[model samples]
Target: MAKKTTQATPKAAENEQQSATAQKPHILPDRVWLVLARRAYEEPLRQVGTVEADDIELARVYARSIYDEFAWVEMALVPRETLVTVIEA
Candidate 1:
């Protein structure tokens, strides 16, 4: 009789997952967020914004809030002014 090897073992699967996670891009603590273009839509699917997030969870929270707050196109959390940078040496 011959023994067969499985396609994936528990340890192998875990290691694969770990490696996949490590391969993902590292998010920073803060990011430049576009303030506009997220409040014009009426449906949840329509509202979309871009921002730098520390993690995927934070990005999700921000997207949800933007959708809910702009349900009626009244309340907006995004800023009006363009991005500003000050350099000090």
Candidate 2:
């Protein structure tokens, strides 16, 4: 006696293919942003920290939320890729 094998129907195979396609990894829009802030007008902007966000507005909000403990007079966020490196250590 031979063992019986069950085969998937056409619809089931299509659904399986769709599910496999859907299960593929999706790339997120996040980018590394450098946060700059200054305590006072006299002080220069300093690289306080970094944040990951999809866009500049979100990065700004995230940076402020994370680093707002200080009484900073000015704050700015720029994508890390935009920074021109003069020297590397």
Q: Judging by TM-score against the true structure, name the best candidate.
A: 2
**Worst window of 10 by summed lDDT in candidate 1:** 74-83
RMSD each, Å: 13.0, 7.1
Q: Which portions of model 1 miss their true places by more than 4 Å?
A: 1-3, 28-89
lDDT of 2 by residue, 9-83 (tens): 999999999999898847675799989999999999999999999877888789989998899999888888987
- Tell how far residue 66 is off in model 2, in angstroms: 0.4
Residue 3 in model 1: shift from native, Å?
A: 7.2
Q: What lDDT would each prediction earn against the true structure?
A: 0.54, 0.89
- Per-candidate TM-scores read 0.26, 0.65
